[model samples]
Target: MWNRLFNKKSSVQRKILVSFLGLIIFPLGLFSYASMSVSKETIRKKEISSSLKTLELIADKLNIMASDLTAISNLYFANSSLYDLLKPPQGLGIYEENAKKDFLIKTMINYKYAYTWMDYNTTLFGKNGFELHTYYEGRKIGLDSIKNEPWYAEVVKANSGIVWVSDPSPKLIPTVDDDHFVSAVRILKDFESGTMLGIFLISVSESFLYKQYGNAVQDYEQVLLIDDKGIVISAPDKKMIGQAISSFGERTNKLADESGHFTTKVNKRNMLITYDSVGKTGWKIIAYTPLKELYADIGKIERLTILLFLSVLAISILVSYFIARRLSIPIQRLFTSMKKVEMGNLSERSDVTGEDEIGELARKFNRMVSRIEDLRDRVSAEQEMKRKTEFRALQSQINTHFLYNTLASIRSMLMIDPPEKVDAIIVALVRLLKKTLTEKGEFIPIAEEMDNLRNYIRIQEARQHEHLRVVFEVDEQIMHLKTLKLLLQPIVENAIFHGIEPKPTPGTVLIQGELSDNKVWFRIRDDGVGYSGFPPSDTELDITELVLEQSAGMGLRNIRDRIRLHYGAGGELSVISRSEGGTDVVLSIPAIMDPEELKL
Candidate 1:
């Protein structure tokens, strides 16, 4: 059922389907990954914190043990019997070597301490050097090396206070890797001054440390011991107990604090190592938890989370199929209407049936299409009107293209005749063509338009021996004002064809323009028969304004139309005439024409 509703039958609907599916799949997958990562990290942190705490507790016990050893050493150093023996025994203090050894061994056995120390009573050392005693248990005094042994020299140097190491050592005791060990040494003190007189030593087995730690395993995760030099004195890795550790790149000493966790490699195993040091001894207790084990349980939780996420996503996909199909029904209808609009049917529109955002978009889309169709119709009508105007203008257009061909034909006519009249026609045509076709622009300076009038005079001279004469007039700015192409040419043509051509004698024709009151006034005047083969004036042009205006429009109608299209109605025209004498016409057009509007 789901597959049939949201199939690949249409790509647009399929995109909607895929969008809904992503809403389920991607977020669930991301949440699963995040939850798993947090779970794994939390577990690792708990393990490391627990291990550091265990190490701190072990260090606390070591502090107590070291204190007790100090107290014992202090007490023995102040003992009067041992202190008096530091000088001369006086009587009982003097003794034989073998006998002295046997007596001290008995004292040790009674005390049951690991070992005891004593220096020779010099006054009592009558015949031999200083005597030494190495005693254990109650009376087991064995061979002594007072002169060469390191422990014997250390006690004498310490002279008074206690010195004990809370560390693991394999030197004198038999024990497994986990067994803990320590030692103590001190100097005998004078009974009166409490000054050191001799030295004593003791070595305790790991049994004392074992009892201290009894069930420390569960209380804390790990425990270790570090000495004054930052060496690992007590640790699970037995080999590292004696070997020193250097910082990777530090120039100075690197020591663990009171308690904290750090990474270190021991026995080629990278571990989370936590340690705390015994205050006075400088020895530390260290514990390590393998990061791999801590992460192991967390990994299982992560896998389960991912599985749950996949199951949820699978169910969500099933639900989304229906939701996507329901949502896409309206969008499918919108696309159908849009296709109809694309195929030359602008009247087609979407039927929006809801007030949701998507429905609003469809309604707006339909309105936009309606507006576009309206604009297209308006543009089509405007183009049709413009085509008629251009065609009519082109029918009467005799300017640049017309003159070029006429002059080229006239040049050929000159070659065949070789007469003065032909030569004059050739010269007149050359001047005429230049004046009409300007290199600068379609709108030329009045000076250039006047140049065309001179050519017209020359052509008439050759054709009818100067039947008419002309004059020009203008202002400085008006001379440069842009006017339409061949504006004067047609005015001159009308005067010659209707006015001067029928005259019995020569006549006057004038062409000129002037700037006045921010506008330009152009005039063409002639003394001739006016209209319809009559005298100088006629009723066919009875309204001077009508003849001048219409002729101005016909002569400059395109120009006025182009100007009105470009500028406005303020562009005007006028005409004046008498039946026999002449006619005058003027164009009141914009003088300050925009150069951009004047571009060809």
Candidate 2:
């Protein structure tokens, strides 16, 4: 089945449609499943983290409330006036005793109003019985009525400082009903003797706990407050309060961590459980949420992903058919054209046209056929031209030998006459001809080229007799560097014939050479009639066209072309008709120490 599906006999459209469906559907389905799994886990973790944060916030508020109650109790114990009232003179009269009681009652009332968390304030004097101050008024209770209370005994037994106790049973007090309270209890001592004088108690209602954590209860199915002894101190179901946490499920031991979250099953329902401690109260706030309820959105996403995959599979079939047709038609046309060209048909061409890669291939194929036809037509003509050029070059070599032999004969004749001035001229001419005719190489040292230029200048000066002045400013370091032969002499000859000869006064030709940035530079400036018999123009003038237009243009053109051919783009020649009554020809070429280093 797989071989039949992928066989070459299948149409392009069918193959593309099958391939596209396989590529798109398989990965999309796999990715959707993976994404759904990751998203489900992410939602579970985020919900647990959010519940833990809420639980921690409620625990912090509870701790702040406890700390506030403890601070108020400390303030009362530090009050000297309260201490004086509690320890009255032994023989005080009724009026004075009554006055002290009134002062003490006023102080206690003020404290109850000052600290909102403190619901009831009470003091138990060792001898004077207990005084209770609620929001409304003061009352006196006999020592026997409250001394036997469970928290009272606990506070007395742990006698060094303040002790916190959550009343297991709600005690009825005036101005507050049926609500249990968490109390801060401390012992008061006489300032002078450091002896225990009384017991201090500040109690806050348990309804404060519900108010602080009420928002969190709405977010979860059940919220429980459990103590370290595995006892449920508070619960959403009021009847469950004061019961052991094990009664709910098997989660009592996991509350040892200060703050954490976990997943557990209780009564056949999976639940996410989060808990945090409430200060040092040995009590923890635990929130429980059912997993099914928490992940309701994930179910919807799974269904939507299935629907999307089906829609994408249908769209891919239609798109892949048209795309495959568009690509395959051009390729088929290109293959036909290639076969025609293979059968010796050079004019065959592909009509494919677009900006895509297939279009570019067809265009290149057409250009290749045209280029081959052009080469076939030009082959015979190039052969004929090559034969003529070689014949002329051979004849030119023979003429060079004949000229050298003629100059040697003249030198022998001049030695016989022995005229001093004529001998110098003949010697200079022979040196110039030998440098030009001998095929040592195309490149020579700058010093040797300069020597040839000086020899030509000597012959010209001897003939013209003070009509021309030449100046050489060559850097010693660059004299050994190699440059093209005959590069400077032609320009010097053009300057003498066209520039210096035309001027009525004697003209100076300055030849300057320098080395810079791995290139050799030459500047030939003549103080003669400049371009068009005026000072040179500043605009760029094409040296090739300008040289061709002159009477001696061939020499200048030959020099420029030779330099360009040898150095390619690295060689440059420019003619700058100077503004100061002269013409300057600047030439630049790559600096080389030997002829073999020349690229050409």
Candidate 3:
């Protein structure tokens, strides 16, 4: 056996030690690389997050500046003095081109910008849209001529009380007359008459946001001032000052006010980016870091892990070479014994004699296989016996139930009825017997079952004339749906026999079928002697008598048991009735099955 084991080991192309070593070594190298890469990713995300915080601070300040600008614009547009002056000649407006006594100092205080002014014109279509009237600090120091400015016509053309932010325009400076002052302009007016013949312009420095947030962060990170349209209203970079951020704007349109971080390829390099938005203006702040730079230390760790993994692989191969040989003999015996059992030689046993754990494990395994064989035989016999028991129970309930009752009814009809009545009675009895015995098959179409039920009810009516009125209201669509044989008749018979027969006055026996919620439900109800107040679960009710005593309730117990057996516990025939009125026996069953499955 030792010589054979040596020969087997030599014939193998890949030694077990080498196979084991590669398994341990390869995953270690891969995991080490993956761990370092994940660490790098985490670091990159942290940096981007930190930068995003700084961007948020800048974004908040910029949004506040824009809101404050809007507030001031609204205040100017709502000014009543200016609003009354722009009204039609109702005696409330100023008629001069210069500032009046009441407007002189107040307008100066409100319009604090260097070249701020309120200009007026005789007509909206005048050659100059507006003539400078109330100028702050004089046009000599920092003044602007609105007559020829591109914004002058635009501002005057718009109706008063509306703010408009125009494109960049030129304004005249004090010392340098040609040095244009950049400004945001709007129109001021009266509320009574929507007339506009003047302009309200605020001259602001071009480097408004850049001078404030330009040096707030490092060169690696960016700070942007975005407007409602995601346009770069102001920024440190001259090129990006008025440019739009379409990508960010598009994302904002998709995700409203929610904020998060993401890793995506930007300019062909992987970058970690995080951003947030000012809810009202749709302005955003974005911070980014290069993934490779953030994860550089992780890459170093990955290289060290790979080197360590390779060394471990070598040491493992040296150790496992002798270890694998030591255990190979024991494992070979398991393979041999398992093959014999798989080939139906259940008597075969593993005989790897030893004092260690493997020897004990082999002994237990042999014992377990022996018990498994014994269990197989026992379970087979038990299942066969269970199947027979179920069929016998169903047969007992179906066969002996209505047969003897039909015979007794026939004997009574023969004694009292005439010849013609006897012939009709025999024909109906034959049809009822065919249905009860189910000579056609165990399973019948629902339409056939209804025909059988009509015959049965007719014969019963012959016996108990006007004592019971059986009314059937079956849904037409459910006529072709299949169900178990005689699933409902037993219950209906019980309701009439137990519930309605004892009542003094003739009572209604109502049988209805309908397709509701993909299932067939038949309600056998009777407005008759009603129900017993006794509960089925109560111990005093003699459940054995109700179940097996062949009393009026015996058929109902049989019906319920058959339903549970066929439907595997989900199907049921539950009885619900109201006292002194009617009893309703509900028979619920599945309605559809393929023809092949129906055979089963």
Candidate 4:
């Protein structure tokens, strides 16, 4: 089936159409694919890079806040008054003790005002049953309760240094509000004696964590702070603050890297996760962006690329079609003319006009058909008159003269022209004479006829001393098509001698042939001196009238009679005098390939 579909001969038009489509569509499709791939990766990388940078910034800010809290703790450790006040109160007057308590409360209030930005609550626990609070004033739980707490042990183990407690339990921070908080716990000690005094706790509200990077969070994105234990210390969603980070995703374990980014599924949704370590805190600042949201721009680009590719493809197809039509239509016209000539149309001429190969073929076809008509007429007259012997002698004499003239032309070229060109002209003349004298067939392929015409033209070019240009435009389709022999040479002879030879300057003879309306039409136009009496730009005229009015030569008269005898009313001959000082000769004949299809 494939062979059957593809085996048929393709027309020039179809081949051109397919070639143009391939040229445009293949490259366009490849370019579109490459651009989409590059653009997708580039956009994804750029977005990921930007997200990682933001995560790093969030980590840096958290480090800064942690440092500030540590600095505040150091201040408390340096204050001798704080150490003395936090130490156990010795036996003394009740009023004195009360005054000492008042002094301590005032000092705490002063420190709160001094660092209002920290927005932290402080609790001081003396060795005695004394507890003093700042914001959580009602929480009077004793030192025994604090020592029993899980995080309290972690603080004591720090050996007088500060310890950060994330996701603090309610018992550790018995505040009036239900808001979550993280605490910085440290031992208050005497600077001089190095004696431990009391435990100091600074509880930072959840607002502190959110406020640090709240504005950085976007829709469908998560910003989280996870403690060393992988506990969610801070997050946009308050409920998630105390939960294990692993609850978000099993792949969260990959966050073990000090700082990096990866793609994973979180809560069953694909996510792009970027993490950075908070400075010296053993905690991670992480950004979670849904992959869908992260690559949304890439999606848009994909759609736009497809749209552009389709648009360009559509335009390419349109342009290719027009180009193919332009290139193939002329060939089709020429093919039609060849078909007409093949059908025994002795007067058939191609009307295709151009300096291109196809145009040259048309001119050659027209000239060949004219020569055939003239030969047929001569043959018919000779038979009627019963003068075959005399006619043969006369034709031999004509052939001798023609060969003599060509030899003279070649001899003249040897002196002024190059040896190679003279040699080529000699070869052309030999071939032209051989075909003319030796070929006996009345009808020959149009291709052979055009080849003979080419040889004749080459000899003429070498023969002419002046600038004489001849252009023949004929279609290739008619090359193998049959036509009467010896058609083109005589007309070309007349065009050179009668038309171009008279012009003083350079001149051009154009021969064109094409098919129209089941008939082959040919035109021979020369930019040279035209005949005196013919009307300028004549489209149609009777051959007999042209012969009488213009006193046409025997060659023209014979060709006209032959066309009439062979093709009846379908054969046409016209001679026009151009307004621009030239001559236009046109010939046409019915398209009939088979002898039986002929009117005769």
Candidate 5:
């Protein structure tokens, strides 16, 4: 099917149109594809860079909040009054212990109200079995419940420094209504002995962390604060907190790097993951953005590219159509004219004209048609003249009256002259009959033509009542040259019948032949009435007029036509009437001795 479509023959216009479309479409398509690829890549990189910057900003904000929490936790270390209440009671009674616990609770409540914007809860655990909470309506617990917990060991390892914990068990770290919270825990120690004392836990609601970076989150995006253990510490979705970060995706393993981005699938949706370290926390600020969202602008660019490509293709088709028509129309005209010429309409011509090659061809075609038409007319006329000339030549050769007159003249001569003279006349008559009646080739040697002419002259002289003096001066060098048979006989016949026969006195006919200019020429003259019934003296005669108009019974025009038709430009005939009262006819023909020259 492909071959059938492609291999079929197509017109010039269709081919040109297709070629133009190909030229435009191929490059345009390549450029569009390249541009789209570049644009997509550029947008992706820019989004990645921008996403990384957002993560960094969120990390900075989280770092500031962590610092503030650490500073607030440090405040109790400097408070001697809170320290006195937290100290172990050496000899106090049950009521006194209760009274001291009440005093510590009141002090923590006052401190909590001091920084209401912080909205934090406090938990104090003594190295002894005592514990107190400034949250959950003053709920009290014992430190024995958290003594074996993993975070309890972290707080002791931290010594006087702060330890950040997120979403701890309510039994280990108390909170209101089992709500999620992040806490800063630190050990309280005596400044003088550097000896460990009770533990101080400062807890803030999870909303504190969320509010720090919540505005940076988007609908198709996720933001997570992941701890060093790959645990999600804080997130907009409260349930995700305290879960291993790997629960989001296996690609979370990449978060081990300090900073960078990678692509992954999260919840069956492709996503671009960007992450950065939060200062001093061993935690990461990880942002998960859907791949589609990161490259959203690329979709718009792709649509625009398709539209532009279609527009270019449409314009190219239109332009190609116009150009094809402009180029093919003239050639189509020329083709139409050619078909007419092929069908024998020689008058047909292309009318297109301009400076282009097609126009030049059209002009040449017009001239060619004109030339062909003229040649056809000339050939048609020549054919008619040749038919008439052949018939006249046959009639002249077979005239019974001329034969009877010749025989009668012989009989009269037999009575008046000697037998030898009579025999000579009879021999001339027999030779003339043999030469005229024989079927022979079109060309004969000059010597043979001259012999036949002598035979004809003898018969004419015998038939005429006047004395006829005919002279021959033929050159030996041209005697064997080839010429059309009976060429000279008709001219000599005209000189006798038309030039001398009507004269008051018998005239002499002079016949001369010689080689000139590599050709054979003959001169036939008669000293009798010159230009009496012909065109004026020395007036040039066209071959057509001489053959068709001047070809009376004399046959002078027939001889000229035969010469011209045989030799083309190599042969010529001219007539001149002299002041001395005689007519001269000069005939020139190619000196062709070889048969091969005939083909040329």
Candidate 6:
């Protein structure tokens, strides 16, 4: 059933419609759906991963800040002046004691200058009952007040090392107005005696943490920093700080992993939360986005997909319809014309106006039939011309009787006187007659043709008592080249008879031959009565009629016809009157050398 519907005999319009819908539209629709689904999922996953990476980077910055504070605290504890101030006085004067206090104060001030993050630093000497603080004029702090502080006690209990204390509310140094600080405290010990010297505290502002990590949270709908105890240490909302993590919902529990994302409810709104842990600090950075906002573009993409599919479907249908008609109409016309041509109607033609392969085929077919018709007419014309030429040749044979009459005259002269001049004349006439009668071939060597020309000129000069002066200017290089026989004799004859015979004085006839480019040329010029009827050099003349009528030379006309027949268009003959009251005939033909003649 499918084959019947899709067979080649089916209408092209139906075939095109079915093919476009099945092969193009179907696959395009399937691919668009699959790509939309994959693109949505890929974009969502990539966005989640990018948010997690940003959180991890913020965590790294926090870890670095903690390490910096720890290093600064350790440096301050190892100062020798702190140990000296803690040691027993050893009978020193109050002046020296004050000097040492001044040195310790200068050292702490230098620490504050070097570490910009350090908001305030203080030291308590247990033995000397003196306290030093970075703020305040006296640089003194009451030891009793901090001695009972939990962080202070924790540092002393540790005794031999540093302790980090996350203080929600730190007591401000006497004149320092900051109430929130993250403190690193360490117990100072005498290096030689292992005696407890003092307690050192370095407090960093909590605002510095927010300032460093704030940009990471800017892109999220909401962000929070939660400690291991599930307390919100920092948030975009300052009031949210110090609140229980449960206020944000159970999503905080999922943040126990190093980094992750999950869909959950936050304040009764759908949210996607991504979180990353902040190293060993027991803190995690969390970012959240509302689901509706995150996938807002997906809805637009779905709408666009449907619109694009419909646009493509409509365009494909139109294109398919036009393309089917464009191709089928020309083909149908060609097939119809071919049927006509098959029935022996060669005049039938297909429309070849379109610019396509089918149009080209139609043009080629028309050209083929035109060429066949041309060949048939040309063959018929050639047969008719051949018959006419044979008839002319037969009529031209009547001139041979003149040769017989000349032979008879030569016989009579031989009987009357056997003079050397007469014998030479008879010998020249015999050679000319032998060549004209015996040689039936159309082509001969240029050297042989020149010999014949010399013989004919000799006989003519003898008859005219040497009144005609014959000059030969032949290039030996082209003497062996073959050309149409009797080509030059006729031109030479016209030069002597019509050109020189009418002149009162002795006239010189020049026969010159040369090879140039790929052609052999001969020019016969005579100082005789110039023929004014000669055509211009560039004009194409039918030499048969031109020579026979105006030049009154049958030999010239016959030579022209033979040259044209043998060499086609390449052979040419032209006659023009020379400015010096003479005539010049130029003959040109392709140079074909005989190999056997070359050896001779």
Ranking of models by TM-score: 5, 4, 1, 2, 6, 3
The most accurate candidate by lDDT is 5
Q: Give the per-residue lDDT digits (tens) of candidate 1, residues 120-218.
A: 111111112233433212331222323244444554566554565433223223212224455675555555665544445554445445445546654
Residue 342 of model 6 has an lDDT of: 81
Residues 360-420, candidate 6, lDDT per residue (tens digit)? 9999989987877688679869976894575358325424533654565566666664588
* 1-600: candidate 4 lDDT, tens digit per residue: 434333458777777777787788889889888887887678678867887787788888878777877877777777665655665666445686678777877877887788777677777787766677875666477787657677877777797777778745666456624367777788876666767677887778777878888888677788888888888888888888888888876455687788888888877888878888986567888888887887787788878888898898888878888988887888898888778878877766777899988788878878888988899999878774653454344446546756776888787888899999888888888788888777375456677877888888888877785568999898665565555455556567667767787789888989787767877777778888665455555443333465435543445554565566556687887766666667777777666565346736
TM-score of predicted structure 1 = 0.45
Worst 10 residues of 1 by lDDT: 118-127
List the candidate numbers ranked by lDDT, top first.
5, 4, 2, 6, 3, 1
The TM-score, computed over Cα atoms with residue i paired to residue i, of candidate 6 is: 0.43
RMSD of 6: 19.1
Please count the clashing residue pairs in each candidate, in the order shown.
18, 1, 4, 30, 0, 0
lDDT of 5 by residue, 1-600 (tens): 434333557667877787788789999999999988898788778878988999889888777767767777777777664555556666456787787678777877877777766667877777655676776545556677667767878888877888877765577444534467777888887676676768888887777777778888677788888777788878888889888887666555677678999888888988888899987677898888887876687888888889989998988899999999999999888999999999999989898988999999999999999999999999989986885577456446534534765787788887777888778888997987677656665677888988988887876776564568899999999988888777787778777767887888888999999998898889998997654466444553423344336534346666655666666688888776665577788888889986469546
Clashing pairs in 5: none
Off by over 4 Å in 1: 1-49, 79-110, 113-156, 165-181, 189-198, 206-223, 247-256, 263-271, 340-600
- The C-alpha stretches of model 5 lying farther than 4 A from their native spots are 1-9, 34-42, 80-103, 172-178, 190-195, 250-253, 336-348, 366-600
Query: Against the hidden reference, what TM-scores do the models get?
Result: 0.45, 0.45, 0.38, 0.55, 0.57, 0.43
lDDT of 3 by residue, 444-487 (tens): 67887888778877777877777889888999898887776777
The window of 10 residues in a row where model 2 has the poorest summed lDDT is 168-177
| Residue 484, model 4: Cα distance from true site in angstroms | 33
Q: Give the Cα lDDT of each candidate.
A: 0.58, 0.73, 0.61, 0.74, 0.76, 0.72
Which residue ranges in model 6 land beyond 4 Å of their true spot?
1-36, 86-93, 116-129, 136-143, 146-154, 168-170, 173-176, 191-197, 251-253, 299-303, 306-600
Residue 302 deviation, candidate 4, in Å? 4.3
Native-vs-model 6 lDDT?
Answer: 0.72
Q: Residue 433 lDDT in model 3?
A: 69
